[model samples]
Target chain A: MADRPVSDIELKAPKGDWRDAHVELRKGTFSNASLPKDLIALGLPNPRKWQPTDLDWQLPPDWKGILLRGMRERLAKYRSFRLFMDVCVRCGACADKCHFYLGSGDPKNMPFARAELIRSVYRRYFTLSGRLFRSLADARDLTEDVVKEWFYYFYQCTECRRCSVYCPFGIDTAEITIIVRELLSLIGVSTHWVTEPAANCYRVGNHLGIAPHAFKDALDFARDELRELTGLDIEIPISRKGAEILFVMPSADYFATPHYYTLLGYMMLFHEIGLDFTVSAYASEGGNFGLFHSNDLMKRLNAKIYEEAKRLGVRWILGGECGHMWRVLHQYMDTMNGPADFLEVPVSPLTGTRFANAASTKMVHICEFTADLLYHEKIKLDPSRNDEYVVTYHDSCNPSRAMGLLEEPRYVLKRACNHFHEMPAKTIREYTFCCGSGAGLGNDENMEMRLRGGFPRAQAVRHVREAHGVNLLACICAIDKATLPTLMDYWVPGVQVAGVHELLGNALVMKGAKERTTNLRGEPLAKETANA
Target chain B: MATPATVEERWLAAAATVSGGLIAAHTLTERDPFRNPIGHVLRRNLAALVREFFGAMDEAAIDAAFGEIMALRSIQDLSVERAVGFVFRLRGIVREEAPQMQPAEAEARIDRLAISAFTQYLACRERLADLKLNEQLRALGVARRRTAHRGGAPA
Candidate 1:
C-alpha cells in the first residue's frame, strides 16, 4: 500500500508565545548510542557491554540522586552555571544562532531549546518556584528518561558558543553543555568520543595517545618532508632545555594529513627566521577535549604546556593552529594554572611585535606571530605559488568568538595566496559556522549528525564555491583542516581544504631550495606549468 | 471530500503537510518555534517535486529538489522507514489534491519517485562513507610520504 499517510494532516504553528511551545518527548528519536568499551577506555566507571540505547544503561543504583547532587555541587562551584540557569527570560534571540538548529531543522537543537533541556531539569530539582508550579515554570522531574535526554542532546552540541554572541543576557549554551556533561560524568554517563580523548590527553599529553619517541619520530618525518621540499635541513629540537620559546601543537598536526603539511610550514617559517623554539614531546598536543567535559579536566590536560615551558626554561610559549586549544589558553589556562610569571611576555622575534593581548597567558598564536612577520617584510613570499587555489578563510568558533582572532588568519591568507574570497558577510568573521566536528565530536560513528551539524557551514562554503570558484577552504583550526575537507567533499564537491600555514608552506621562498615541482601535498604546482 | 479551489492552494496545502512532518521529527523530544531554513527548503523542494513528477518540469528539477532533501536527511539519524518515508508522502497529497486521479497510476508515480529519492539518499550516504575512507587514505598517503622522506634523509 503506497498510500503514504499525507491525509488528515492539520498543519498549525505552535501558538501563544513561541517560548511556551509544547515540548514533546517522543521515544526512538535519538538512537546513536555511545559504546561501553569507549567509556572504559576513557577511564569512566561504568559496567562493560552496556550501551546507552539499551533498556538497562547499567547506571548505578542511585543514579538519579547522584545527578541531582552533582548538579547542586556544580551550581555552588560555578557561578556561571547558577547565573545561566537563573537568568534566561526566554527572549528567543539565540534560538536560530546554533548551526545545529540551522542545519538539522530540529527545534530541540536550537540553542534556547537545548539549554532548556537542562534548565527545565534544573528548575524541577533546585528552584522553589519550579516545584510550586511545575508546568508553568517549564520544570520537569529528573527521571531516568531525563538522564537519557541529557546524554543524547548534550553531546550533540559542539559547544561553539555562537549562541552566546547573540544572547541579550549573554547566556552561554557552551557553558551549560559543559556543566551538564560534568553532571553526566559524575553518573558515568558520557560519550566515548569525548572521554577517550580526555583520557588520552591526560595520560599521554596528546589526544591520539602517541608515545614520546613516536611523537619525536613523527616530527622527524615532518622535518624530512620539509628537507625534501626545501632542500634545507631544519633542526626540530624536541624537549630541549634552555630553548627560548616552547612550541606546542595539536598532535594531529604531527600524524594527520593536511595538518602535517602545515606542521612542515611551521618548521620552514621557524627555520627561515632562525627563531629559537623547541617543540616538546611531552606537551605535544594543543587541542584539549577536557574543555568539552569539565573545567578541572581541561586544566589537567592544559597544565602540561606550561609545565614543559617552565621545564625547558623557555621565555614564552608559541601555540600552533587549533580552535579550543586557543580558547583554553586565552580564557581558562591563566585562571586555572597560572601565575606564569615564570615565563616572560611573548614578542615576535622577527619583528619585535609584543603580543599585548597574550601578555597574561604568555602564549602567542602562530598566526599572530606570522602575520606580524609578514607585516614587517621579514619572510620572502611568492603569492602566485598558491595561484591555483582561490581561497576563503573560515573563522573557527573558539578563535573568533572566544579570543577575537578575526583578522590575523586572513592577514596571513591574503599575503600567502594570490586569490582570496570571503564567504557571505553573515557567515564569515564573528558569525562563522562550525566545522561540525569540534569539541571531540569528530568520530566516524556519528558522521550523520556531524554532517547535519556541518551543513550550515558547508552551505556557506558552497556559496563561495559557486560564486568565486573557491577551491581551497583555508582555516587556522586543525579540526577544520581535518574535518572540512570531508565536509566539502560530501556537500560541495571539488572544494579542497587546507590550513593557512599549508598555503604559506607552498608560497614561502626558501633560500637555496631546489627547483619546486609540487605543492605541500606533493601535487604539482599549477603555476609551475604556466611558468614553464 | 472536496479539494482546494486553486492550483496554488492545493500545492501549498500539500507542502505544508509534508514539511510539517519533517519538522515534527526534530521535535520528537521537545518543541520550539516551528520555523527553520531546513523547513523552508523542504517546503520548496516538495512543491518543486510535485511540479516535476506531474511533467510541469523535467526529471532534473526533481533530482535537484531530491538532492537537497537527501543532503539534509543524510545528516539526520533516521532509519530506512523514516528516511525515504517523506518521498512517498506525496502519494496521499496526490490522492487528495489531484483531480480524478487513478489510484494505480498515482501509486506508480509515487513508487518511481520513492525509488529515485532512495537512490539519491544512498548516493549521499555512499559519498559520506567514501569521503571518510578517502580521509583515512589521505592521512596514510601523507604518512607514507613523510616516512619516505625520513628514510631518504641525508645521514
Candidate 2:
C-alpha cells in the first residue's frame, strides 16, 4: 500500500516563460525503449535493436520505401483514412480533449499534434502542394527519424476516439492511428505488447494459450466456488453442442481476479434462471488484441467466435463484460466476418426477451440480458446484499463510446446495489476516458504513461470518493478489473474495485441455498459477520 | 493619464497587474484560454494567492490554493525554476506598489511561498517517478507470474 495517495493537483506551477522549453521537448517525437527480447518472443519481423532511446532503430534499407508504399496502398483502400487525412483543420478543440495530453503535457500527445506526425508524412508523399513547397506546407520526407516518431506516438494512442467526439469535422483519430499502426506493421515495426497477444490468440485459441482441458478446469473451478458460496449445484456446459446459447468472454475472466468473480456471477445468474448456455474452449477469448495490431488479424481472431457458435449449434452468442472485445463485436465483427445467416437472433430463454439491439450481430451483451431479466423482475435480487459498498460505474471507453452501452450496466447496478453515483457527465458515456492502458498498452514498460493517461479517470473517481464517500469503483472492462485495482491503489487508495456482476453474484438469491455468509471474494457479509 | 492620489489605490491597481501577470504566465501554453480547465484553475489559484498577500488567508488555504495551481502545472515538463518562479513574481509587485510595507516582511512571505511551491512540485515529480517504478515492478510481477505458470521458476 502507498504511504500517501497522490493527487495530480498538487504538482502544478506557473509556466512563466517556459513554453518554448516544453514545446521543444515534446517536438522530439521519441519514446522510452522497447525490449528486444519481448519483440523477439512476439516474432515481429525485424532484426532491429528494440530500444527507442538508442535512436538507431535498425530498420531495413528499403524501410522508407516500404512505409511510403504501404501508406499509398491504404490511402486508396480506406476512404475513411484518406478523408481523415484530408479533413483535419487543427482547430485545437481536440488538443486538450486527449487524456494523454492532459496527463503528460506533451504537445505531441495532443490529438492534433499526434495527427501531424503522420499528416506531415502524408503531405510530403501524397499532396502536390506538400511536394512542391514542403516547408511552407508543413510536409517532410519519410525518413528514419519520421519512422521512429510514428513508432513512438502511434503506440501512445489507445484509439478511444474521445477526440473525434469533439472534432468539428467528426474526424476519428482512432482510425488514423489504426492506419498508421497498420502502415508501421508493414515494415515489421510493431510493439510486442500488442503482437504477442495476437500471436497467442492465433495459435492457442486464447491470449493466455489455455488449452481445451485447461479451459474446462477453469470453468470447473468456478463451479466449485459457486457450490461453496451459494450451495447450489451449477453446471457449466463446456463446448456442449446444441446448447441454446453460446457464451464467450475474455479469457482473463477465466483466469484473473475480480474478473473470475464476474465469471461466478455469470454462473449464478445462469443457474438462477435455469438458462442453457455453453462455454467454448475453442473460442475461449472474446478480446481481439489484433484490433490493436491490424484489422486483418482482428478479423482472423474474431472468426473463431462465430465458428465455435456454429459448431455448438447455439441460437446466439452472449458476450461477457470486456472493453475492446465489444468494440470489435459491436462495430466491426458483422462486417468483417459475418452475415451470420446460420445463427438465430438472440432471445433470453428464461425471460422470453428478444434483443432487438443485437439482432444483426446475433450476439447480446450479458448486461443487456441481465438487465432485461431484472426489468421484468424475473430474477429475485436482495439489494441489501450489496449494502457494504457504495458503487460508481466507470464507462469503459470502447463499450461506452463504440457500443453506446451506457444504460445497461447502470440498470444492472441500480438493481444490484443500493447506492450508485455517476462520474462527471463530460467524463462518462460518449466522452469517456480510456483506462490509459487499453489497446495492448497495458504493459509494465508503459506504466508511467498509463498512470498519466489514467489521471483524468482517476481524478473523477476521486471526486465521487470525496463527495459521495463512494468506496467501490465498478466497471465492465476486464482490463479495468486487472488494471484499475493497481491504478486505484496508487491514485485513490481505499476505493476498492469490482465488476458489476460481482455485486450481482452477491445480491443474487439462489434456490434452496444455505444462508450466505460472504460475498464472491469470500470476505464476510456485514449481517452474518456481525451476528457471528 | 491621471495617477492614483493615494498609496492604497496605487497598491490596489498594482496588485491587479501582478494577478494578471500570474494568470497570463499560467495560460501561455494553453490553446483555448476560456475552455481549458487549467486556465480556470490558474484564475482561481491566482485569486487565492492575491488574497493571501492582502487578506487574512490561513496557511492551510494558501497551501490548498498552491496545490491546485501545482496540479494544473504537473502535466508540463516542469523544472524547479519554472515551477516556483510565479510565486516570486509577486515580490517585485510588492516592492513596487507598497514600499511603505516592510521589504523584509514581503520577501519573507515570498520566500515562504517559494519553499511551499518547490516542495509541492518535487513531491509531484517524485510521485510520477514512483508511479513509473511501481508500474515496471507490477509488470515484472505479472511477467514473473506468467513465467511461473509456464512451469519455470516461481515468482
Model 1 over residues A261-376: C-alpha lDDT tens digits?
Answer: 88888988899899888998889899998898788788888888888888889999998999999999888888899868999988887788888888889999999899999989
Q: Which one is best on lDDT?
A: 1
Global local distance difference test of model 1 = 0.77
Interface RMSD of the predictions, in order shown?
6.3, 11.4
Model 1: residue B73 alpha-carbon error in angstroms: 2.1
Best by DockQ: 1
Per-residue lDDT of model 2, residues A56-85, tens digit only: 567777888888888898899899989988
Candidate 1, TM-score of its B chain: 0.66
What's each prediction's TM-score? 0.89, 0.83
Candidate with the greatest TM-score versus the true structure: 1
Note the DockQ of each predicted structure: 0.30, 0.11
Residue A97 CA error for candidate 2 (Å)?
A: 2.1
Runs off by more than 4 Å, candidate 2: A1-44, A211-214, A526-532, B1-76, B79-155
The TM-score between candidate 2 and the true structure equals: 0.83
Clashes of each: 2, 5
